[model samples]
Target: MPLVNRDQKHYPGLAQTTNYNLSSFKAAEIITRDVVVIGGGSAGTYSAIAIKDKGKSVVFVEIKNRLRSRTETYKDPKSGRGIDIGVIVWYVTPRVGSEPNTTGAVFDLKTGRGLNAPPPNQTAIGIAFQIYTQQLLKYPELDAGMFLPDPAPDDLVMPFGQFASKYGIEAALPTMYSFGAGVGDILATPTVEVMRAWGLSLISSLQGGFLTTARHNNSELYGKAQTELLAAKSLLLRSRVVYTERSTSGVRLVVKTPTGNKLIKAKRLLITIPPKVEILKRFNLTTQETSVFKKFLNTGYYTSVVKNTGLPDTLSVTNFSPDSPYGIPKMPAVYTIGSSVYTPGLKLAFYGAPLTNVTSSLPAKTVKDAIIASIKRQQTANPANPTSFNQTTPTFAEYHSHAPFWLQAKAVDIKAGFYKKLYALQGIRSTFWTGGAWRAQDSSDIWRFTAEQVLPKVLKGL
Candidate 1:
């Protein structure tokens, strides 16, 4: 098993470039590698390490300087004893595990209803025990993070539909989770994502977060993976493929560097790139890959935004999700804005979401002011003091003047063929396959899949 550093949080980033004429630049170095992996996020890092373990030289590249896209911090103001933003981490559980006292309820997920038919007494605590045990397996420090007597040791206290009532609607749930009170879309995801978001949200006030070491950040894990690949001497930082020419001998890859350009002659290639068709088309992909790349060009994704609202000037509600907004389509219940995020009087990370054409798909805004207006509508106008709505935190997303409302805002979500074609592109050049959106979600999961499928296949004939 790949042992990731438990000390840090792995962050990813994607940036746009100013120099479009890079493709015309003169060349410099000549290098060779068994494999070349694009992207430096969780999957990219792990894939590089796994390939290196196969005894092949490799090269890894990134469009941005940093690994992660977003960072979290604290909100201003203070409560009597809680946090600055009122943010909390939440875990899912049945009735029995709440605390020193209080019964828990059990809802069968398969059936999606209360399961009180057969047994005389099947408490929710039974579930609490199962979750705690799972934690024990995932983390070595479980003993330090959990407490048995507390019923809510692993879950967040929820009063869903808070945003709905605040808006004087039948329910305010849509704005709370889907519209995200100006955060990211939290709809149509796997169960794990929902659980993780909820669990972290539940404990925001009490235990802080499922946080890693501050210094290491999550990059440490990827950094360690990079280290494992050191034997390959294949890492190419601050470099990019300017042009690729398929030659009679082999594939010739010309990459641009600060000092000069680099030419690499390779027997085979392995590429893991983003599903953005426009972005992928820039690279000199093979004919087969080019055809697939063109298809991806039409796809888009949603950029996420997370923010804090509903706070007194004197105290901010840190790490908290709004009551579930009733009617919104793609809002998330909770977002990981930050943890223990109290900085005298400033909120740290607030809102982020994928930006896409989905806004057009829904009955919202397609223009700027209209989008912001629609997004602002998603949140209640500050209940305690009606004027408080005007005093909300200024998030990065707001400054960009980008898509504000995230009801299916486009950024993360993509078309179906995008992933399938991306993965199939690997076969265009043997030993080359794309992962991430083409394969899986989690970094570790991507690594496992790559190692199982690609490695042995690459080694077979060679």
Candidate 2:
């Protein structure tokens, strides 16, 4: 890797702005690698591993103490059982492998009975899904990343509800809504965004094509990944980039860790973090990058494990609005409160809110309160057997905020080739980007995108 010098050219207007003198760092304080991967989530971890497999050196930096945000497993104190409050299911992929099929009961909260699709509706759903698949096939570029055409198609940019209605697939909205719980206001979302979230892999998962870890602990994969990176001495957890200097020749970063600051010089940088304006500003983003990133917005999605909930262990309660279109529940709502097969005494609740300026400001306590209140309201609404619904106060054992999730731009922006501009940012100043924002918000999809699309470009000169 080439080191930046005073005489070397840098990205215009972004040269040597940091207070730290580049030459003042001792050799011991400086670390050099072929690539530097930030944000130790699925994409970052996978990219680092892939780079190393190609016999290249890389450094992995993460703000969190651990890697992989979506696969969190909380152990019960008394029973020592692992409860997966985050990412309980994964699409069966060639790389990650699959597990035996498992089935769970879904009940309508209003009726307190099994939620089964009627035969006619089921037929309609099958036909609708076939049509939806056919439609998605027209845009094969979307399967990997945001490689849309120059002028985006109208059907793809329209609201998903309108798209469904136009295609006579409104019968599928209820199922899509249930599966796309964390996407927030799916019907209102653009068709392309909705397809990206609930794409082919997830559709396959709905047909018994998904898997969990053998122990039902999805975090196990990340644990193994951490072990590999630690063995290579290439991972820096609980670390953040304080400053960055990027140029056509290479990239340099000053990372703040627990012990001290370390200077990292690498041929390339891969950013897997959400490209929110506030987060990217720290990197000295170019004007063009800022203009593209500022339009990105995200929804609030949270998950938690609650105990002492009066719900039955065998039942999985899903929200259903009897009067709403396709029975889709309202926004800023608890999508489901259900028992997990791995955790007998506990229940997992998933709540999501639509995009808003204050979406990220909602306190975890408030979310927990809302979930419990929704549960109580559902219990009171069920008339089948009032005794079946207990009134015990539920306590949250574990909670995780997947906020700033499902990142996307407005439909108008997407139609105006926002993604084309976003993808064009790749390799700018030797920095590349990959994440749910750049691809589908799924672990398998992000991994595939990193491996197939971003990695090749990042490794080009290295």
Candidate 2 error regions (>4 Å): 1-18, 93-120, 205-208, 357-361, 382-387
- What lDDT does candidate 1 reach at residue 75? 22
TM-score of 1: 0.50
Using lDDT, give the best candidate's number.
Answer: 2
Model 1 residue 213 distance off true place after TM-score fit, in angstroms: 4.4
| Residues 323-428, model 2: lDDT tens digits | 6777787688778887765566688889888975332546888899888886766556554564466767888889999987888878999988899999999999
Kindly give the stretch of ten consecutive residues in candidate 2 with the minimal lDDT sum: 5-14
Model 1 lDDT vs. the true structure? 0.38
What local distance difference test score does each model get?
Answer: 0.38, 0.80
Model 1 Cα lDDT, one tens digit per residue, 269-328: 556655443444434456666565444211122222234433222332222222222223
Candidate 1: segments with Cα more than 4 A from true spot = 1-28, 66-216, 223-233, 246-250, 286-339, 342-380, 383-423
Q: Give per-model TM-scores.
A: 0.50, 0.90
